[model samples]
Target: MAAVIFLVAAAAGGGSAVWFGAQGWGKAANQSPPVLPPATAEVTRQTLTATSEYDGELGYGVATTTTNRLTGTITGLPDVGDVIKRGQSLYSVDGDPVILLYGELPAYRTLKEGDEGPDVEQLERNLEELGYDGFTVDDEFTWRTAAAVEEWQDDLGLAETGTVELGRVAFLPESRRIDGLEVELGAAATPGQPVLSHTSTAKAVTVQLEPSDLADVKTGAEVEVELPDGKRVPAKITELSTEVQAGSGQQEEASTVVIAVAELSGDKAIEAAAGYDQAAVDLIVTTGERKDVLTVPVTALLALAEGGYGLEVVAGGTTSYVKVDTGLFADGRVEVSGAGIDEGTVVGIPE
Candidate 1:
């Protein structure tokens, strides 16, 4: 098949310059001598990846604040950076420990034998994991459930009330590393006050992006993290969240930022980030990719006198224009395809 050639006149400034139009080619009277471009490059078939790097921080991802649901004198507090797990004491209030339980529901009310809800089921699951048994883990709390709770309370050296009081247990999604202490030891622990802050124990990199950059970012996408020491490691996007950042001045406007959390996998990735408790890193996310496709330098593409784009193909001692469709543009190269474009084909680079 013959390739369609769209001939257009070169602009007055130079032989490589061409006029842009909405419909058809320019008249032959507008043509100029030396129609070929001064510089030429050969089309090659290769994989092209369009990626963007953003500033990120390597740490334990995001921190969440734990508030006090019980009122008492703060007897004990965990040190900063302490890793607290399930069945462990998060903090002490009035000589009683606030046990840590793994669950998504927050402790809202006093759970007694007659109580029945998802919160009850959550508590029962934790209790079972802590070695308490002889009761079914269900939403309903019965006498059998109270027996197990009593046993747990006894093990924790608490009063065998058989009823879980509000604030007796703190529920978190997983084990957490204590980030900071909001209250000091011996301080008064008031209800609804922040007691401590913590984050997941796993290593992660967090990157903030503007709204416009979020179009290609999705969960489970693979990315690369460049550590402070110049070492690169692989990571995957596990979570995405939105945060509102306050402006510095009264006249400034608050902006909504998307926070991407990428979890580090394997021993190498974990060990590479272990040295830095919190440090700046670079997150390289691939936005687009083209595999085994013919590509040319972006400069080779000409804004044709017709509506679309064209490339001046140089073959033997002659040159001609070939209409081409452009794809992923990355690293100064663009994916191009047309009837006459192929691997090793020489294309003119417009001046």
Candidate 2:
């Protein structure tokens, strides 16, 4: 009976194996292992430097505005945005003959050195009537001009500055004229006032500094000014007035300061604006820098078995895990300090 039972059990086990083989399970077990896909990686480097960057705008160095001395109608003046030179004739007062007055002027009236018109004779006659000598009514302010100015000042009870103050002559400042027609010919002007505008534009820049950043800046700080044409101009902080000016954003409680910079390299555009341009300005102030550090991509690190972090290194088609220490991060890279990993070592990426 025991022999018969053993034969039956062997026959049952054989039948079961035949059924499973016909189902393809046996053939699948004998198939070759699966091949992994290719992985991308980067080699480690010993020397790595990190940098921070900022973006801003380009602007003019200086800009000047003009106002009128006497309130008059706009007349006999160049149009706006016109370039002018020193001593250019801007406008005339009325059709009336001009009178020149100065506390420092000679008592005898004489034509200026550049005067060559018929008015020169009239000037000489006027000077002689004032009882000044050295001029034969020749219409010129000569050395006798100095004596005449002293006499004039004495008569007016005013101190002489060795220069004439032409207050009465249709009364325009010599060597400079109105830049543009600020008022009309019939406009009335008061004594000792500005009728035309003038600007030097020598060394100027329009700098916009954050009021909150005042702690990092002051007058005389180094600055770099860029022009619209990609020109980089060197400048130094000159004025740091706390006064806020009009800008794109207007906040009653919020505040900002306008900084003025002077070009140290003597830029022509800056000099013209007198160190104050209407264009925008950009400023670069470095906060810090770091260099020569080991770094890696943030994606390469993996959790290790012993509660540490590691990366997988591939060599000879075999993957070996490596443990590493990490440090600072800048941009997309993180600084790492590790052992058994030399520069240019290719690390494997996990599947």
Candidate 3:
């Protein structure tokens, strides 16, 4: 015998309205008005996913403004979308190339053969990476380091000063794809002036999630990106930023937005979104998923009088009541489990 998760307590003896509370059934004699027929549903197994979709922007990533450090006329600028690599000119100032180097520490001062600091180490590390040899990679710049600098300078057509001064090179964490330009050619470029903005070449989708959605948005969760062409691409949550921005509306209150990054992985995703740039897409976040679970139409649920819930399990001509616990509720079907219920158990529904 299956234990009933009675939503309402069944009476010991037949009484006026036999059913007790929210979801209990009346005594079989009073269950139906002669006109309405009984309806039934099969209890079966299937997979389910609890998810939601939101509008998202598809692109490389957020653009970071690239600022200049040395004052000069902006003689040359890379075309938007140019992929700048090491030894290449990021932008020319007074016709001298501010060579691109891969590093995180920004150059803060004029570096010479005698300087010693983390900046020097960054410069030396880049020099070695650029194929300049004979200089041990270290913070202390030696004579060999100066020689390497001179060779690099000659290659870029600059005076071989054998020293790196602020503004002669730009250090980024890695290669970058120029996303946009902020200044025009021949514009006066001053220290700390905005030059341009860029992002990684890889494709990603960004979402500005509302506060309520944060609970379902987790790093590493799988998501589906619906492209503008109506095609779907698989992606994963790569990053999340909890940022607070002040509102400019009449209320003038601050609001926190969860900024998420969904990276499109695999060759298929790349091929699908290869031609797109700054396009709108749909992001389906799968908060939860379940498979092979017992489920029935939501209508089968009866709020029990005692607090839980009960399923009106119909057997033969009479309805046998059974208590049940609920699980995932999706697509008008809900998960349920209780004693006595089987894959083919029939449950009752209102007419």
- Considering every candidate listed, which one attains the maximal TM-score? 1
Candidate 1 residue-wise lDDT, 1-351, digit = tens: 011233444433233222221222333577553345688999999999999999999998988999999988999889998999999999999999999999999999999999999999999999999888999999999999999999999999999989999999999999999999998899998999899999889989989988788888889998999999999999999989998999999999999999999988788999888899889999989999999999999988877544577887776555677778899999999999987689999987865
* C-alpha TM-score for every candidate: 0.86, 0.38, 0.83
Ranking by lDDT: 1, 3, 2
lDDT of candidate model 3 versus the reference: 0.81
How many pairs of residues collide in model 1?
Answer: 0
Give the per-residue lDDT digits (tens) of candidate 2, residues 237-287.
Answer: 565665655565655454566554444445554553344334554555433
lDDT of 3 by residue, 96-184 (tens): 87888988887778999899988899998888888888888888998999999999888889999998888888888888899999999
Residue 146, candidate 1: C-alpha displacement in angstroms: 0.9
Quote the positional error of residue 135 for candidate 2 in Å.
27
Candidate 1 yields a Cα-based lDDT of: 0.85
Q: Candidate 2: TM-score?
A: 0.38
lDDT of 3 at 291: 95
lDDT: the better of candidates 2 and 3: 3
Q: Rate the local accuracy (lDDT) of all candidates.
A: 0.85, 0.46, 0.81
Q: Candidate 3 — number of clashing residue pairs?
A: 5
